[model samples]
Structure formats: C-alpha cells, structure tokens
Target: MPLPNGYSINAASSDESEDAERLIETVSVPPQCCSARLNLAVLMFFGFSVVYGLRVNLSVAMVAMVNNTDPKPWENHSVVPAACPRSSGAENTSDTFQQPDGVPQYPWDSETQGWLLGAFFFGYLCTQIPGGYLSGHYGGKLFLGLGVLGTAALTVLTPLAARMGSYWLFALRALEGFGEGVTYPAMMAMWARWAPPLERSRLMTLSGSGGNFGAFLALPLTGYICQALGWPAVFYLFGGAGCLWAVFWFSLVSDDPRTHPRISKEEKDYIINAIGPQGTGHGWSVPVLSMLLSVPLWAIIVTQMCANWSYYTLLTSLPSYMNNILHFDLQSNGFLSALPYLGAWLVSTLSGVVADKLIEKKVLSVTNVRKLFTLIGQILPAVFLVLVSYSGCSHILTVTFLTLSTTIGGTSASGVFINQIDIAPRYAGFLLGITNTFGTIPGIVAPIATGYFTEDNTLAGWRKVFWVSAGIGVCGAIVFTIFGSGELQPWAVTEEERAETDKRRSGSISQ
Candidate 1:
C-alpha cells in the first residue's frame, strides 16, 4: 500500500518548512507479531479480565454469603409440577459452600440483595462522561490504572463494608462503580492512538473479550473459593490480583505508541502512517447538542440500554435463580451460572469474524449487516429467555435456554456495540461513554427489579422477570432496526475535521 516514489501518506502541504518536510516519511508496513501494539492488546486483554473479575465475583459469592431460611415460606408458592427431581445439591446440604462454621452470613432479603448487587452501577453512571473527556484529553493510561486500582482496593474492603450494614455496603460499592466506570471509555481513548486503521477492530475485540473471559473463569473459581476457603477469600484474592495488575499497567504501558521506549522504529513509523490525526481536544470540543439530536445515536443508546437490561438480569439475578428456584448448591450454582458466560465469550469472538467476512464479501451494506446481527442478537435472546421461563424444573432445559440466550446475545458486540465508532470515529470514546452510561442503568435497575419481583423465589415470579426482559429486548431490536445507520453523520465534521478529511482524501487520490 505504500505510494509510488515513497510519498508520505498524510499528504502534507508542499509549502512545509524544511524540518517539517524532513519529518514526513513514506508509509511503513505493520509488524504481524511481537510488536508493541500487539503487546498492548495482550496486556489490555488481561487488564479487562482482572477488572471484570472484580465486577462479577459478587454475583457468585452472594450465594454463599447470604443465609436463606430453610424452605418453609416459598415451597407452596414456588413453581408447580417440579418434574425434575431435586438435585442432591439442594437436598444433600451436608454442607453447601463448605459453610465454614465461623463464616458470617447476612440475613438480607431478596430486594436488599438486589440493591447490593446493583450498587456498583450507581457510581458507574456518574463517572462515564467525565471519564471519557478526561481520558480523551489527557491520556487514558493514568485514569485506567487508577480506576482499576480504586475498584480493587474497594473490593478488598467489601466484606468489611457489608458487615458495617447495608448502607455502608451501598456506599462502598457505589465508589467502586465510580472507579470502574472509566474503564471502557479510557480503553477507547487508548485505542485512538494505539490502533492503526486496519488493526482497530482486531485489537479492540481482543482486548474487550476479556470481560467475557473473566466472567467465565471467575464464576467457577469463586465458587470453589467460597467452598474451600470462604466467601471473603473470593474478594481478597481477586481484589489483590486487580491491585497488582494496576501497578503492572503503570509500569509497562504508555499513552501514545510513538512515545513508547521499547517500540521499534519501523513499527512506530508504520503505526503513525496508518493512523491519521484523529480526535479533537486541544482547541476543539464535541458538539453535544448535535449528538443529542442524532437519531442513529439514540438508536444505539436505546438498543444498548435494552440489550444490557437482559444481560444484567442474567448477570446479577441468574445465580439467585439457580440457588433458590432451581435449588442449586453454591458450587453447582456458580458453575451453572458461569456456563452462559463461557458460551457468550466464545460466540462473541466468532460473531465479529462473521460480520467482517460478510462485509468483505459485499453481501450486505455495513448498516444492513449491523441491523441484521443486532436483530439476531436481540430477538433470539428474547425468545430464549421466554423459553427459559417455561423450562420448569428441568435443569438441563433451563441451562440450555440460559446458555443460548447469552451465546446468541454475543452477536450484539458486532452490531450496535461497535456502531458508535462507525458513525463517528473521532468521538468514538465519548460516544461509548454515553452509551455505557445508559447501559449501566440496566445493571442498576435489573437486579433491584428482579429482587422485587422474586421476593418468594416462586416460579411465577421468575417467569414474569423473564417475560419482562424478553419484552424489553424485543423493543430495543425493533427500534434499532428501524433507526440505525452505519454511515457517519454530517454533523461529525467541523472546519478542522473537514480539513483533515480533505487531506486524507487528497492523499488517497494521490496514491
């Protein structure tokens, strides 16, 4: 792709001073492996993994942490025809989660537990906009490292906070939410500099998939920790790892690739040529009002919000459902709950590949493929959740339904999830901050709503929960299908942006 006679890809002005002209060089080729960018992607993958591990550990440990009343209250009100015999996990109670004699268990009600589980998102919402702007303007590394460090430190204190009372737990978790909220936006900012045009999707997906992987591994492992050591150990071990990772991040990472000490000159030059000047922070600012008026932006927001409602419902509530309604022991509950995330993690990677292939083949417009996959992601998950509702006492059927719901929902990663960058690459990080803010709403509301609905852990209550989630998913898909667009919005261009575009266009033509 290098131009004839070694012309610079940036198409700089001919009137440049001697020094500026000397700095311009022909486009260099990217390294395939052992390159600085790939190293960043790998470390970032683990960064997301550790952060997400910190996020989901509560869902599984909450099973062992709460002391439920022995059966009498909901037995009569629970779902009928319980055809599947009770699992030994429910009946054997010889000692579930190892129930270490001295371990403390809270007498929290379902609604309160819901409140506790959803507490993280309370702080998550408040930080997104400011985090996006700060990370974009200053550099993502410091914020990203600090965010994880704060969350990890708070996580280690979670047991103490909970023991202090429900209010204390809420305040502490809200702070953790505040810390972790910067994660996605901060990473997006990093990618704006680290990712070349051709490598953007690959690098981003590689790093982002860590969330799914973290949930998959952490759940079963947390179950074992709760069983073998104690619930407190779950928090201690994961939080400790998170703290260590933050230190490692600061030691190894740089905000811009051009400034990295260990990066090869060839790779640095290649990355520079491949990624043009992007973002507006120095003298310009985002057009917030125009974004508010954008239909496509709203569609992404609405779809993200609705889709995440179902996701958080499963994330926060699924373990409770397995434990109380399905009567799974702590160990079984964690493994079963984690299964869906494992399926989701695998499918998420594949769906992006499928999306890219379809686009490469020219089988559909970028917009059409996005809508198509989004519909597949949303509608099918709704159907599966509906099935999960009717699965009755059949553990096999319920697990299958749950797994299918999450596995198929993975397609959304290739859909509206990445559409923000397509619509406005320059503002991609900020837009993600906006979308994730609304998306975090589900994480807050779904758990509380689920707790409110399933007070007695009755079959009928869980049914209603699934039905509501299904309905929301359907509505989100419908809105996105009708209003989503892949093309960049006209308002994305300002005078400075327009000039940058003209330069790039002229460069392409010159080639």
Candidate 2:
C-alpha cells in the first residue's frame, strides 16, 4: 500500500510488514464523529450498572432472607412488630403464627449471613489477573460480555441454590463473583483503548458512576420486589435484566475503534492521535516484577483496599443496620440504604467534570489534582464515618452522615481510580486487576468481621465497625498523599521506545 509522503515501509520480514501495515492503517483512517466514543462511554456506564445490580441484589434481599430476630433474650420473639409502624396488617397479625408484618425470616445467624455475603468475593479474587491478561491480549468485548452473561445465569439460579442449603448457595454466589470479577479489568482494558489522557477522568468516572446508580436502584428495588413477590423475585428480576443487558453489550460494543465497523474515520483518527501509539515492539514486555516493587503502585493498592473496606462494610451491612439499629422495615431500609449511593453517583459525576476542567485549564498539575481529590475523598469520609458512629439512634442524623461519607468518597472516582491510567495506559487493565484484587479482600474480610463484632446488633458493636473503617481510610489517605503519583513511570517504556519518543519530540520542535 502507498504510504504518507515522508514515511516509507521498510520491512525485513512478514512480522515487520504486518506491523508496518497496522501502523499505516491507524494513521491513515478517515475522520470520525466524536459521538462514536461518547456512545462507547454510555455503553460502559450501563454495563457497570448491570454488574453492580447483579452483585448487590443479595444484600437487600438478605434482610428478608434470614431471620432478623433481635439478639437480646428480653425481646419478645412471639410479638415481633413490623419493621416499621406503616407496615400493612401490623396490628392484625396473630402473634402465635406470624411475626409482625409476616415477612419470612430464616434461622441463619449473623456469622453465617456474613459468610454468605462474602462468598462472592472469593470467586471474584480468583479471576482478576487472568481476565486482564485475556482482555489485553485477545479483546475486551467477548470477555466483558461473557462475564456479565455468566453472572446473570448464576444469579437466576440463586433461589434454587439457597433452597439446596447454605453451602450450595455459597458455591453459587462464588461462581457469580467469579463472573463479575472479570468486569472491571475488562472495562479498564476498554478504557485503555478508548480514553484520551485529558478526558480519562470524565469517561472513567462516567462509567464508574454506574456502580453507584446500580446500588442506588438495586437497594430500593430489591426491597420492594421482595416485599411484593418474594425474595426469590429479587434474584429472578435482576438476573433476567443482566441477561438482557449482555445481549446488547455483545452486539453493540467492539474492542477498539479500529475493529468497530460503524466508527467514522474522523473519530478513529481523533482517538489515535489522542491516545498515542498502540502495541509494543518485539522484546517489550510488562515489567510485572518492577511494578510489584514500585512504591506508588503499592500506595494505590493500599488506598484501594482501604476505600473498599468502607465501601463493602456499607454495601453488605447497611441494610442490616437499618433494620436492627434504626428499626427500618424492609421497604424503608431499602430506600434509606440506597440514598447515600444516590449522593455518591451525583458527586462522582460532578467530580469527573471538575477534574477535567481543572486539568484542561492548567490550574493544577495531574499529580496534584489526583492527590488533592484523594485526600478530600478519604479524609471527609473518615470524618463523617466517625460522626455516624456517634449519631446514636437519630435516624436522620445517621443517614445524613452516611450519605455525606459516600458523597465525599465519590471523588475518588476522579482520583486514584483514574490515576493508574495516567501513570501507565498500556498496563491500566493489569494494574486495575492488581489493585482490585486487594480491594476485594476487604469485601471478604470486612463483612465477616462486622458479623462477628455486631453479633449483638447494638449501637456499640456497629460503632466499632465504623471506627475501624474510618481508621483505615485515614491511614490510606496519609500514605497515598505522600507516595502516590500520576506521572507516567519510566519503567512503562523501554530504552528503544524512549529514544523514539524523544526523537518525535525533537522532530516536532524543529518543525
């Protein structure tokens, strides 16, 4: 094929010829519409929403799944009042046969409940690195589509597994987690292909907000579904919705613009110019050992772990707290629990916009911007989390604190979450996999710990949980502020690549 005016194809072998062809094809593409990538971002947004929806439905449904009888001996098990006074037939229900409003409860204790909740993360942690590697090498489209599809399939089978008993249910949930674990890495790979440096915060945050949105919707929706139909319906409904979404995802999405049939040439060119070159020359390999030893990467891993500790604590245990401590009924519990994620979604979206604006205006360097928001997200949440511990039984005050904590933490979507991309776009997927594996540990540990500590289900027990979460968040913020970086690491490129980049810069300067 003919090449650009000054550029010539000099290939010594078939492999070199193939590489040269790809490079020319990337640069020679026609102009494409900007909306092509925007549409990709929108699809990613909804994809994450489905992921969290399937993941979190169990949290709300579990409130009704297990027997939530008071741990205290003095409480009259026979005279169980409705979760709230507004419950229908609260007064008319017979004390002998029915407890309060007649919601079904199981005989499972808090510790068993905790283990069930954490099972998903066990399978989740297993697939991170493999998923990232597959996405980077093969393509993100198939893996991302299959991950959600498999989760949906498992979700639809949850009620049956639960009926088979706790072990069966645990195994099922673990498989579901395994499926969902691939999602973040797959999506990070997609972003590595699609997101331009200046627009990374906004695009990544937009997709990430779907998690908050899913949580916001899933809590209330699961509550109402469990109330009207049964807890099983919550599983059936969300699982079916996830399946439906997978169809669209597989049909509509491509791994990158070059592979997308419908993408305009202009948009393709724009993406290529903005994201820089793709592929490494022969002999270039990811410095996995070096990355493992890097201080900044470890800082990100620590902060992610701490952040998820708070996130998972709230995600898994909030509904229980609302029911036990605050005395919210199933419906009320769902609504109240979902409120903070609503604030988080809104704040996350806004933070992305603000982060992009600040960087575009050159008011702050990328590293400082990441550090600034990381501190805000971590510190403010720590403060509010402690306040939540002291809110007593004042429902309004407690809810306010929880909402404020998540709202502030939402800023991390624009902070450390996107910082990995800034430091190394080529390995963004792998780095996300490494950090998220650590992050999932809190998901596994925090719930079990909370269940152990809050077996009494008292304000005091819950306070201990919040205190631990707050302390972890505070420590992470301090370490990240000192060691975290947004600048691209030298190890990301080899000596040959560095020389080529320097040559390009010198050529541009002379022109």
Candidate 3:
C-alpha cells in the first residue's frame, strides 16, 4: 500500500495514475526551503502591477498633456461657471513638454478627456469571456504574457497617437484596453489551478493588490517623469519596463505546478491533493444560462459594478478633482492622488491574511464571510465618499475620507473577488469574466457621467457625482448581502465529473 513517491492520502484505494500523480501534488508543507506557489504569487503580483502601470499612466499625464489657455469645451455646458484658478508656472513647472505658450495643443475639453479615459473599457469589454475561456482551456501562461506585451507595445505609441488627433489617441487607448482585458480572467484561471482553498485569499489578494500598487506608483512616478523627461517619457519608461517584464514572465512562470519546471515533487503532490478534482476539460461548456440566472453570480456582478464605478471614477478623475477643487499643482496632484490607493493596497494585504484565518479557523462560514467583508467594502466607502463630498476645500479631511473609502473597499479583494472561486473553483475564470464584464461597464460609464456632471469643474457638480457613487454603493451592498453565496452549485459538475466521483467513491468502499 505504498503511495506514489512516498505521498500519503486520507482516501484509500486510489489506483488511478492521474490520481496518484495528482495526490502527489497536494499536501502539507514539503521539506523544501521555499514554496513554488509563493513564487507564482510573487510573479502574478508584479504582473498585475505592470498591467495597471501601463493603464493608469495616461490619467496622471493628462494633467500636463493638454493646454489650459482656452476655456474648456464643456464650460458652456457647465452647471455653474468654473471659478477654479488654473495652475500657475511656479506649481506647473517650466518643463518643455508642457510648453503651454509655445507648443501646439489638442482641442479637447473635460468631456473629451472623459471619453479618452473611458475608451479603454470599450475595447476592454469585448474580450472578457473569450479571454476566460482561452486561458482555461489553453493555459494562462501564453495569454497573460502576450496580453501584457501587447499593452506595453501600444503604450509606447501613445504620444505619437496623441500628436495625431483626439480620435487617434482614443483609438490607441482602446487598443491598449483590448490587450489588457485578458489579464484578470487569465490570472483567475491560473490561480484556480494554483491556490489551495485555505490559502486562496492570501495568494489571490497578493496578486490583486498589485493593481493598487501600480496606481500608487504610477501617479507619483508619471508626474515626476512628466516634470523631468516630459509626458512622452512617462509612456516610454513604463512601456519599456512592461516589455522587460514580459521577457521575464515567459522565462519564469508556468500555468500550474504540473508544468512548472522548478517546483519540488512534494509541493506538487500537496497542491494536487489539496485542490481536489479540477473539473475542467476540452470542449467544456460554461453553463451560461445557469450562470445568468444564479443569484450569487448576479450579486457578484452588481457589487463589482458598484465597486468599479467608484474606483474608475477616482482613477480617472482624482487628479483633476485635486487640481481644480483644492488647487494642487501637477506634482502635488500626482502625489496626493496616489495616496488613497496606497491605503487600498495596505488594506487589501491585511484583509487577505485576516480573511484566510477566519475561514481556516471556521469562525465564519464562507458565505457569511463573503457577505460580511462585502458589506464592509461597500457601506464604509459609501459613507466616506459622501463625507469627501461635504469636506469640500478642507484638504486634509478630504484626502483622509478618500483614503478610508479606498482602503475599506479594498476588502472586496478577499470578499467578492475570491468568492467566485469558493462557489465555482472549476469555472472561476469564466465566472470572473462574466462579473468583470458588468464591472467594466462602470469603467466605461462612470468617467463619462462624472464628466457630464462636473463639466464646469465646480464643487456643486462634483458633489453630484459623489452622491451618485454613494447611492450605487448602498444599492450594491444591499443586493449582495441578500443574494450572495459561497456554496458550489450542482450544475458546476458535468455528468462525466459526477461519474468519476461515484467511481472513486465505490472503489474506496470496495477496498
């Protein structure tokens, strides 16, 4: 009754070679010095960091990207005339890139800026489902790496695109979005294969936090780059870094432990056994109708949409908000704009550890844990968002509230984001893709809507935008708390999978 490679399993009478090979993969910690899974998490963390780095650099650069000499096009559409003072030379710096007096300027307004920010999501929206399917069926290694590489290549072309015209710049940004759209779903598929249930929150959030980290770095870094090397250098530097990352990504990582060359045998055995049956195969259908009708799935979709509404709004608009409302200069605006995401990254990192411990110790049911954290992520941000609106010109108070909102919302990393895996580990990729499709809608809509409201860049208009965000947050929290769940559905298993289960059970009994 010796196990394969000295591996032991609680279940007896398993003679299948695949089972033997797999059981060898899952276990308690091996005698190895380090876990390969940890390495994968680290790579994935930095991978997502690179994705957001390329994505958000434009937002920071936008402050210095265009001329403010003429009245913004949306000024006529204003709720009230924008009384905010434009940045003077002392704050803006006499960088040749800004070249406000001497250089040619694009004829864009707040509305046009919103369109540019939102255009990425238009192309981003098109590829989610296909990306999920491709990553799951084919392996995420190629999809994830190529996706980042494509985005990096496009990013370097952004300055040239901007020089062409507004429409051209928009098109280029959309193309970049198309490349990046695959990232989350591919990462989800890969994590489905790698993450143990107990360790799920920790690993997934560690990777997810990279997005916040990217935002954290990009705002300040891009601002400084724009100040020194000019706006184009921001694109060149981040894009080049992304290209280098792609080279390292291809060399360093694989989709799963089974394929990773450097992983230890004991660690491989531990992963396979701990992960249980991965009910995936070629020609698998995604159970589309069931997913559409599922309450928990819809809850995730709605909540994510709400979250992204606030997140994308802030990501795209925060610099302008600071610049206009509180009168922070470009460098100060970038520094202040990045602060909230730093809080977000910190919260996400801490909450991941706390969530895993709660589930591991059985202090809360998985369903309840998701609901609790989702509520925290939702309601706290709603409250703080409203507080931010009212705080008005009080710089310290406004920043603190914005930071709290982002930090609390970061709990969703462990909550709704990882809940898909709890309920549908086999199909987590597709599930995330579906939810993210809804989630990305906010990315498309929020900036545009905020722009329309804040066209005059007046405090009254900005207040309206925050109010709308808070309302959506409340509705999402309510719906998700009532309908969300973490239990696997029966339909998650195919007929073949059920038969395999029965056969394994019968074999164990007959022994």
In terms of TM-score, which candidate is strongest? 3
Local accuracy of candidate 1 as per-residue lDDT tens digits, 1-511: 2233343222233232321332233345666589888888888888888888898899988888877634432354343332234556453241334457788888777888999999999999999878877877777898889989999999999889878988998899899999999988888878777775444556776778778888888888988899898899999999999999987899999888777999998887677655445533322478889999999999999999999999999988888888777777777778888998887777777776677656545566567778998999999999999999999988889999999999889888778887876566657778889989998999999999998888766788899999999999999999999999766566654454456546666888999
| Tens-digit per-residue lDDT, 214-238, candidate 3 | 9999998988887777788889999
- The 10 consecutive residues of candidate 1 with the worst lDDT sum are 14-23
Rank order (by lDDT, best first): 3, 1, 2
Off by over 4 Å in 2: 1-34, 69-105, 278-284, 494-497, 504-511
Point out the worst 10-residue segment of candidate 2 by lDDT: 5-14
Quote each prediction's TM-score.
0.88, 0.87, 0.89
Pairs with backbone N, CA or C atoms under 3 Å apart (clashes), candidate 1 = none
User: What TM-score would you give candidate 2 relative to the actual structure?
Assistant: 0.87
How much lDDT does candidate 2 score? 0.78
Error of 2 at 329 (Å): 0.8
State the lDDT at 15 in candidate 3.
41
Clashing pairs in 2: 30-265, 30-266, 31-265, 31-266, 32-265, 32-266, 32-267, 66-106, 67-106
lDDT of 2 by residue, 132-238 (tens): 77776666788888898999889999888887889999999999999888888888888878876666788889888999999999999988888788788888888
